[model samples]
Target: MRRLLVGLIVAVLTVTGLLALRAELMTVEVEQPEGSYTEVLVAADVVRENADVRAEMTHGLVSTCRLLVNADVVEQSFRAVGDGVFAFRLRPGLDEFDRRELRGCLSDLRVQHLRVHVRHLQTVTPADDDRRRDGTPAAGRR
Candidate 1:
């Protein structure tokens, strides 16, 4: 009876291992696109209470750029939207792999140690969208 139980356990473990291997091999791998494939622009503003913290935040963004090799990740891509206010963007849509890579890289960037207040976050229309003069997206646009 003990031998039979052991054989059953071994058989179950072997089957589980084989299934895991097959699933891993079957996953579709997408190569990073040479050009824009997806895009999600985020508008944000960094809190301006102290210059020292602000500089530190800017410095930290360089690490974000380095960790993720994409040149389009936002850094100084901000513009004046109002008095004492500015707008920034966080470009997305690289792919699931890039996002996952960025998430992992952010952990190493030590963002938890930084203090920057980003408020009034909103998603802007994608650049790929061509809008008409009336503020509606152009026809037959992706």
Candidate 2:
């Protein structure tokens, strides 16, 4: 009987030790162009304690422009210029394009060393009265 109890305690200790070895985890809030948000799991190392990240998409004359910031995303906004390139305020002590270019296409934006998978969107003109006739509020119209 004593041997059985010892074996059970050893098994429990092994399980507890394994669980404690797991890496730190982090949660990410992803905001899409349509103003929808989703929570994603990421490594704790991706986001620092005070690091800021900001990303937004704007509809332009020809195509959509994606404005993103790595250091202070929450504090920056990009102007939607009629042309292809966008214009943003250069923060104090920060140069233009201080953020890294997200590679592997805009749909797959990897930020803060985390893989952020974004959905591609179809740009519907705001002047399309017929589209809003269905009573569904247009995205970002409000």
Candidate 3:
């Protein structure tokens, strides 16, 4: 009985050690706040698709942009602009701050070949009483 208990403890310790070795986790702090926002248009390119390059780049950029901008994806299209060229329209929760963060993030993006590159960043100001795709008034003033 004592041997069985010792074996169980060893197994538990092994599992715990493996868990500790896993990827680091992001530390969550205060919730992302929302404020007046402008639409941000971003462009990138996928020079190649061999070895799932397109899919990998799309997922990676979307993830990083989300982290930096705290924006909702208004729209995204792969190869919509041209072959291997991608476009994304993000509506950030915060106005100027998110815009700066997104621009900064895109500027910081870099890789050697077949890498996602932020070719453009544009801030689109909506007219008063702007409507969404569903034709309803956007979050701010109506």
Looking at model 1, residue 110 earns an lDDT score of 48
On the 0 to 100 scale, the lDDT of residue 9 in model 1 is 100
lDDT of 2 by residue, 1-142 (tens): 9999999999999988777644212123323233222111111122342323222222111022133423221233344332223333212211112111221223243333423332222223333334578777654211
Question: lDDT at 100 for candidate 3?
Answer: 50
* Candidate 3: regions farther than 4 A off: 1-52, 75-79, 109-114, 128-142
Best of the candidates, TM-score: 3
Model 3: how far is 77 from its true place, Å? 5.7
In terms of TM-score, how similar is model 2 to the real structure?
A: 0.22
lDDT (10s digit) by residue, model 1, range 43-118: 2224434544544454455346434636354656554444334444445434444444443443342454443333
On lDDT, the candidate that comes out on top is 3
The predicted structure with the larger TM-score, 2 or 3, is 3
TM-score of model 3 (CA atoms): 0.44
Model 2, runs deviating above 4 Å: 1-51, 54-104, 108-114, 126-129, 134-142
lDDT digits (tens) for residues 1-142 of candidate 3: 9999999999999998877654223223323334333433344554544644655565566667667656666654323465555566555444544555555555454432335555655544343235555587555411
Instruction: Specify the poorest-scoring 10-residue window by lDDT in model 3.
Output: 23-32
How much lDDT does each candidate structure score? 0.45, 0.30, 0.52
